[model samples]
Target: MSTTLILLILCSVMLSSIAQIVLKTGMSNPGVLNAVQSGVAMQMITTISTNLYVIGGLTLYFASAAVWLLVLARVDVSFAYPFVGLGFVVTMLLAFFINGEVLSTAKVIGTLCIALGVAIMAQG
Candidate 1:
């Protein structure tokens, strides 16, 4: 893959990972949690739709998808999709640092495995 294509794939993955973190942060808010617990679908929708963080997260998702479409146009799915695994690693680290989530040995091992898989895929 060319440098530009690699960057594009990485950008898509990073945007998607960041979007997951932002969505998690938005949903973790007490108000959003309460809305979820309320058992009212409309209430939950209203709460999430009005949340700036949620909106931002959704926007990021759109941006990521746009970039991913470009990547799909330029590369084989087999070659391009493995990069999405990197998003798991990025999300794990973001959750650990940004949300104070714990990183167990198992998770670390799994993340390493994912990184290795992506690297192997890239080399193919």
Candidate 2:
């Protein structure tokens, strides 16, 4: 891959990871669910509309999609898709550190595997 493609892949993965983190932070506020079993979808919408983190995260997702489209035009989907796996690794570590979420042995192993898989595909 060229330098530009590599950069795009990195940007795509980083944006995705950051978006996931921000969304999780926004959703951490339990009240955001408002009315679940009651089946009032609009309440959920209202909550999301009002949450800055959620709004920002969703916006980042759109931005990522736009860049990802450019990336798709430039490279094979199979080659590019594996790069997204890095998002999982990024998210896992962020969650563990930022949220104080658990980082079990299994999770560590799984994340390492994702990194390995992406590297394997990148070699091809």
Please, what is the whole-model Cα lDDT of each candidate in the order they appear? 0.97, 0.88
lDDT of candidate 1 over 6-112, digit per residue (tens):
99999999999999999999999999999999989999999989998999999999999999999999999999999999999999999999999999999999999
Off by over 4 Å in 1: none
Tens digit per residue, CA lDDT, model 2, 58-101? 98898889889999999999989999999999999989888899
**Clash pairs, model 2 backbone:** none
Per-candidate TM equals 0.97, 0.91
Best by TM-score: 1
What is the model-wide C-alpha lDDT for candidate 1? Answer: 0.97
